[model samples]
Target chain A: MTNIEINTYLTFGYLLWIIAYLVAFVAFRDRARSGAIFRAALIVLLCIHTGSIVLRWVESYQMGIGHAPLSNLYESLVFFSWSVALALIVVWRRFGTDLVALLGVPIVFLILASTFLIDPNIRPLIPALQSNWLVAHVFTCFLGYAGFAVSFVAALLLLVARSSAKAAELLPGKKLLDEIVYRSILIGFPLLTLGIITGAAWAEHAWGTYWSWDPKETWSLVTWLVYAGFLHARLSRGWSGGRTALLSVVGFCAVMFTYFGVNYLPGLHSYF
Target chain B: MKKSKTMETGSSESVSILFQIKAFFTSVRTTVFLLFTIALGAILGTVVPQGEPLEHIAMSGNTFLYRLALILDINNIFRSWWFTSLLGLLTLNILGCLFQRVPSIWQDLRGRNPKTSFKLHFRSSLTIAQLKDRLVPVGQEIMRAAPVISGTRDTQHYSWVKGRIYLIGFPLIHIGIIVILLGSVIGAFWGYKGHMMIAEGDSSNKFALIPSGEARTLPFTITVDGFKLVKYPTGEPKEFRSNVRLTQDGKDMLTGSILVNHPLTYEGISLFQADYKVLGVKDVKLSFKTKEGEDLVKVADPRHDIDIPGTDVKLKTLSLDPGTIAQGPGIQVSVPGKSDKPQLVSIYQKDKRPLNIDGVEIRFLGFTPLYATGLQIGYDPGVRIVWLGCTMLVLGFILTLFTNLQKLSIELGGSSKGTDVAISGRSRKLRKEFRQKVEGAFAGITELRRET
Candidate 1:
């Protein structure tokens, strides 16, 4: 089957996974059992998702225009969904809770479903994207973005817990949610740094200017700075529970701007 | 005595102000505040166009906003005085924090008696010697290091500490960021960026600096031998390459090709394939058939007139079209008659019917587009320093994220029940897992293990 068709099917699988998680949440008293059910189904679905991405790569080579499936908007959205789901599973395993995934999986489903709106044909790579560094830069940035996406979900839940006692009871404790926000940033910040570094190296080779202060480059820096402030506030100032959660939300807004909003501006960093 | 007391009070007041200044720079609040302010400035820079001239803003017809932009230097926010000062303040804050944390980092690295996070007590049937043999390996395996045996035979003690390298994580990461910034500053001062456009089969040693059209001469000459644009079957550009020859004093030093993402460097100045422009038609191929049924073909320069051999007819190309009219690629050629006016004829490439001029048929063939390759010249000596700092930053993250420093202090003593075992430990990560492993190692001691 085609990759887009497989992605469409996987979107439904994620929806089913979310439904099963909700059912287990209300029905089963044992949290671990519910987490196990959600985790097992998501893993099988991700395996198929991974296979489809590989198949897309093979299909491109067969078409005599071989390139990694990360050169345009449609492919980036697909990969981004995969990364979000993978990152959510990692967080669930590390923290031993599926509450964050309850919110994160829907984001994955939305991103996957949105791929149908754009063209998904495997086109040849443009001249500017003909470097191996393009692969490295995109891979690191999206993984870091996935980490931030999970952090945003946890932070949003923390904020919601503050206002509603019902959410407070249904969600994990305030401390665990706070820890999730911090720990996800801890994983994301370094990867984002590496992404920017690789992009600079690629720019120096292709454009002869490493830091051009382009709109996209400036936005990425803005995102980095916001997260840097979040880290300092949480680690050094000992700020948490509410204030740090707010900062995580702001930082993810910057991430979204850097990903989607920068395309509206004129800059060297276009495409996806 | 009263005058002397007033003088002493004044001196103490001055000392207090200086102490407050030190406290301000070293505070984490200052770091967070500065980070947010810089981010705000960058956001403004992106929203408003950056690197544009003040005159351009002045022409925007909003006098109040233009004046505000002028006062704040928002036309180029990144390089404005305020933004650079913010960066400088952040660097100082990092240095202050680094200096304040060094003593503690050194203390941890020295393997001093660290604070224990938890303690466990157990009563065992074995002697102190038997306890040491079994528990020593567990400590060794967990910490990945041998213990320092310290107590007497009655009360045996084993203390294990590992991951001393983790102590440098904080310093390395912060210092690496400072280094990257410093490298960029050095590049801003010492390096140059510019572009050079050279047509195919042309040589140039001069380039224009970016954003300022000032000329600068290179030490060596660059001759573009050829430029090619390869397109995919769908008409999208696939690759651009420029074959160049580097010459010094008329002697060829090197000959190579530069493609996108692949630059050519000579004498520390690298040239990247930035862009390309089609200047004009290079040459056109044309085929002519005389009325005597003899076929003749000649490659003619579009800029010059072509004279028919053994005839007084001359053909001059007015324009060349690349299949604009569905009749395929055609060229407008003017054939001058014996009168004062010239007759224009349209000839299409690969057409079965050719244009006739004075009993001779002329068919237009394809023409090559002359391209000028734009090469970006860069000379940055600080790029290596920036790369070094990036490596250190990545290494620091690896050490901080993957490694966990753990310390174990175990003391075993003889008791009335059998033996009294006291185990206390501390870990930076996975405290519960570490506790479980320590307890599982001593579970053989039987039903008396408890947290203290």
Candidate 2:
């Protein structure tokens, strides 16, 4: 089967994992055993996802136009979902919470499922995208986006736990959720900085201008500024719980807008 | 009474106002507010097309928005006065906050006896001196630093402080941002960016500046040797390279090729391959078939007329067409006819049948496209400064996120029991892991009672 078919199957695999995690959390009552089984399944799926990405890379080489599979929208979406899954697993390992996996896997599934709507054929890179910085810039930026995605899920849980006591039982404690949000941002903020830096470096090399105030570049700056505000609000103002969680939600909205909305505007970043 | 009288004076009133100004600048709330405000302004800048002329914005059809955009300078929010003021204010606030926190941060960096977060009390059977010796190695192993040994012999204190560089994290990141802004300011004041298009075998040393159509002269002259365009088998462009020779006063300076990502720099001015354009057809190839079915092929320049090799006929190319309804990449040629009238015939590159003229069949072949490479010339004195600031920013982030200062203090004193020992420690991160390490290290001393 082709890599696109594998991606479709992996999307369903994530949906199955979500269903299995929820079922095991509710029906079995023995959370650890079921969590381990499903976690192993998730890892197996991630390995397949990784293999598919590598296979796509090799396919591009077989086409005689060798390049990383990070040159277009479909590959970005694929890498995005994979990064989100990796981020969720890392979060679960660090905090020992399966609730995040339940809450975050659906986002991964949605992002992967959305890739079916766009073209998935591997094409040659344009002259402007033929640079080593292309891989570095996209890799760092998507990982940062994944971190923000997980933080966004944690923020939603924190907001829900405030209103519903039943969710408070199923979810992790408020403090742990808040810490997760903060820690995820801490990981994302630096990676985002690196992404912007690499992007500027690439632009300087390709376009002769490090920054031209393009719409896409400006939107990335806006996202960065919003997250900077989030950090300052939490670290300096001593804000937490609902207020910080709301800030995280707003920050993720900016991230999404930076990713998708700027395509509607006229800028140089037309290739996703 | 004297202080009250002074408080009623004008100088005292001015002092209080200054104090309030300082308070506003030193507050984190102001920092957050300014960050969001600039972000909102940048969003507006993107939504509205920036760097456009005022006339274009005026013709945007909304009278009220045009007037507002004109008044607010929203057409160029990044360079507008209000946005610059916001950035300046943010820089001032960061400096103010940094100045306000430096003394405390410095004290913490140098402070010997910091307030502990976790404390453990244990009764040991060893004397105070022996306990100190035993605990020094434990502190070193746990905290990865030697103790300061800063108490009397009766109640000696062995404190280990590691990763003091973490204290500089906030300063480094904030100052790095300031330096970046400073570098940008320097670039804006001194940098020059412009574009020049040079066709193959042509060269110029002047370029038109961006946004404004003003022309600028370069120090050295650039001669275009050739322009190469490589395409994939799928007909997509793979690379564009311009071979150029830089000369000054008839002396050759540098000769190289400039690709899209591989720029050519000389004397602090760099030339980047920005774009390309097809000026006109350079040469065309044509195939002629004699009446005897013999084929003859020759390359001819489109700008000149051609004579038929075996006939008393002259052909002049009137125009070139990329393609027509029944032709692919054909050319219209004017031929001198026997009836004192010029005849027009079109020949295609991939025509199934050749055109019969004067008992000779002629067919058009493919032509070479002439391309002019667009080069962007840039000169910025502050690019190195900007790169330096970026390095500092990355280092600052690594220090802030990856390192932590952990302090372990062991206080030993004599008591009715063999000896009383109190262990206190604090870490900026991983509190549980630090506590576990301390507990594992001292498991044999006593059943350590943890106190908040």
TM-score of chain B of each: 0.89, 0.89
In candidate 2 the C-alpha lDDT for residue B189 amounts to 93
Cα lDDT of model 2 by residue, B1-452, tens digit: 99878768968789989999999999999999999999999999888777777787678787877886788888788999999999999999999999998887798788744677788887777888777767778788887766788776568877788887888888888888888788888889999899999999887999999858699899999999888899988788898999999999989999999999899999999999999898988888888888887899989898999877678787899887889656679888988766889888878888898877778888888888788989999888878887787888889899999888888888888876677788888887778788888978988555344434
True lDDT of residue B409, candidate 1: 85
Tens-place lDDT per residue, model 1, A12-110, is 999988888888788889878667877888889889989889989999999999999887888888899899989998998889768788899999999
- lDDT of the structure predicted as candidate 1: 0.87
What TM-scores do the predictions have?
0.93, 0.94
The window of 10 residues in a row where model 1 chain A has the poorest summed lDDT is: A263-272
lDDT of 1 by residue, B121-182 (tens): 87778778887877788778767778999987578889988777887888899899899889
DockQ by candidate, in order: 0.81, 0.85
Residue pairs of candidate 1 with colliding backbone atoms: none
For the predicted complex of model 1, DockQ is 0.81
Worst 10 residues of 1 chain B by lDDT: B443-452
